[model samples]
Target: MKRQIITFATLIAVVMGVGFSGCTKLTDFEDTNVNPYASTIPVTQNLLTGALRWLPATVNSDVGAIYAQHIGEVQYTDASRFLGINFAYDDFYRGPLLNLQKIIDFNSNPETAPTVVGGGSNANQLAVARILKAYFFFHITNRWGDVPYSEALQQSDNLTPKFDRQQDIYTDLFKELKEAVDQFDSGAPVEGDIFLNGNPDRWKKFANSLRLIMALRLSKADPATGKVEFMDAKSDGVIMTDAESFRYQHLAETANQNAWYARYLTRFDFAISEPFLDYLKSVNDPRIPALADKPTDGNANYVGMKFGLANTTGIGNNSISYIGSGLREQDSPELIISAAHVLFTLAEGEARGWNAAGTPDQVAAAQYYVEGIRESMKQFGTYDATSFAAYIAQPEVAYTPADAIRKISYQRWIALYLNGYEAWMEWRRTGFPILDPGPSPLSIDGEIPRRQAYTTLERDLNLGNYNAVLQSQGPDEVNTRIWIDKP
Candidate 1:
């Protein structure tokens, strides 16, 4: 599949001269399928469409779910056990990043800029591509500390790019985000945006919201820098309401349906994890029924399978609760970021005395916390004013100044239901609502992994640079903490 996408991209470059400079000679004139009038330049819309496909798909259904304890595998539990996990980074560079880079390249050219952009101005199209590139790089660096940044994607200039430090990468990400958002022009609206429908203002909000999240990641290690970035991001405008949430609408067709639905249709092999179920049940969370299924063994309560279980020994499809209908629907929306997340991040920032759209106060923090919860429910179609009021009135859910962080972190964990990678990353950063991997023989050092191991290909093909990172970033093991995960 990846090969096919790359091949198609190559054909586009050959026929239209889209990705890079210079036109290709039509040596294969015998090919009747080639369009004679095809412009010898790539269209920005096509590249934009191809690039957006990877964003939600990678986040929503990746292996990070197992690590986050959002779901337990009924079979093939090796991933849950944190054994022999090595990440492949090649697809990302060759796929979405490749397309996005092509868009930027075509639009950056003075001669081809006007025709390549189609509906949008060259500046707006370039800004959109730059913003997406920053996001893609952010996602990559967050997972595996230092990576190829400055020298990456320069096939001609440098193939084996040296790994940039995480600190340096974060600095560049902030700069890229800010510059990209500022570059949006009213000359013409962006074309072929799958998430925001070409709204540049919404794109600005998404960028600021992403910066807000990224800034908070440095709270523990570098509080001063975190506070500055958080305040700056908040002032720039962020996603503060459900209406502005970043999401991708899935199609009803089998070819382009929700990734989760496609996976479930092929096999019934996952269940809500025991820890996840217990937390929601403990709080009598109103969102539970919408999040997980009711047990099928004549039990009225939801029963999740234990996390880290070696195999599907005692578990049966009818005995355990699977994910609910909201997630499995054919045309379900893939939520990339939500108002709930933004609110929760604001709540945390306020608690830490960082300016986050409101004055820092215990009362303000509590209000934001409650609103975050409500937003999560509203976004998932489970909001009920009366029930939500009752839920918040509980002693456990009530907002108190002393237990503010705990309450915020715990609810944030619950709010991040299907976004397992972010949930796990948050858990690593905050260490709140402590998770337990139930008694399983397949434990790796009796704990969840801090980071995924580097790809075997990187270790073999890029041995020198790979070893340098390993030496600086600790052993090439899952438990080796990333740079941001400082104690």
Candidate 2:
């Protein structure tokens, strides 16, 4: 599949006369299907469509879900046990990032900009490209740390790019997102925006919301900067309603259906983790039924599978709860950033005494906290006035001044369910919910991995840059914490 994508990308490069050298030639497809009379001019809309399609992998990562302890392995357990490392990020660069770069370059060039105007206004297209580029880079840096930044996607000009410091990458990302939002003009909205449907207002809100969340990620490493950025983004505007959430809506067709639906068709390798389910059950979370299904053991119980267990002698589909049917449906939407996430960040900001509306107080923090939870419940279709009120009234769920950060972090984790990468990052940042590595842990030093190792391709192909990063950013191991994950 990856080879096919690279082939398609190479074809695009050939047609457009852009020398994209990010991907290696895996196979010769010269004899394969080729339209000799096809248009040589690049279409920005098609490139944008390809870019958007690659985004689901960023949010739908099974390994990330495992790391967050949101799901457990019912059969194969290597990922849960933290066995895999050195995951490749080439596909991201060779695919979506490359496409986005093309969009920006084509729109920026005066000669080509007019040709691609059918895709959208040149300004709008460039703005969307920049915004998405930042978004993808944000995830990539969070996952791998110290990745290629300034010199990345230079086509044939610089194949072996230098790995920038995570701090610098983040700084530039904030600038990029803010600029992208501000770059939008009163022109036609961007074409092929499957996520926001070419809605500039929603795009602005999404960009600001992402900036807000990224600001919060700097809480530990640089709290002063975090607070300033958080307030600025909040004041600018953000996702404040469920309708404005950033999501990737899947189709009911086999080609673009929900990934979970395809996974469950023949495999039953994942189940709700015992730790996560127990926490939900303990707090009487109304989203429990919405998160998992009852076991088919004839007892009709929502039994969660113990995570990272080496000895899964008897566990099967009949014994543990599967993910909820709604979430696994063919057309189920995959949420990227939501109002609940932004609200939770605001709650945290308030707790930290960073506020734009007014001086922060426990009262405002509590109010934001409750609203965050309410928004999350509503997001999951489990909100009811009585149940919500009762749920928040619980001693564990209720907001208190002393436990404000912890309470807010816990609820945020709940709200971030299924978004494993974000959830894991939050856990690393806040040290909330106190996740314990299970008995049979297999990661470096038997600890939960903090970051993934650089791919072997990096060491072999980009050897100098790879070695330099290892010297500056600690060893290329899962335990090497990223800059933002500082203690």
- Best-performing candidate as measured by lDDT: 2
- Tens digits of per-residue lDDT, candidate 1, 451-474, equal 777778777666788888878888
Worst 10 residues of 2 by lDDT: 1-10
Candidate 1 TM-score, true structure as reference: 0.91
Clashing residue pairs in candidate 1 are none
Residue-level lDDT for 146 in candidate 1: 83
Give lDDT for model 1: 0.81
Root-mean-square deviation of every model: 4.2, 5.1
lDDT of 2 at 270: 86
209: Cα error in model 1, Å: 0.6
Candidate 2, residue 464: how far the Cα is off, in Å: 0.6
List the candidates' TM-scores in order: 0.91, 0.93
Q: Write the per-residue lDDT of candidate 2 for residues 1-487, one digit (tens) a residue.
A: 1222345566675775443244355245454567888876788998999999987888888888899999999988888899998898888988899899999999999988888988899999988999899999999999999999898888667768899999999999999999998899998888888888898888888888999999999988898888888989988998877767778999999999888889898888889899999999999999999999998877666999899899898776797898888998999999989889898898889888887554567887888889899999989999899999999999999999899889988898888888999999999999987898898998988989999998888888788988999999999999999999988
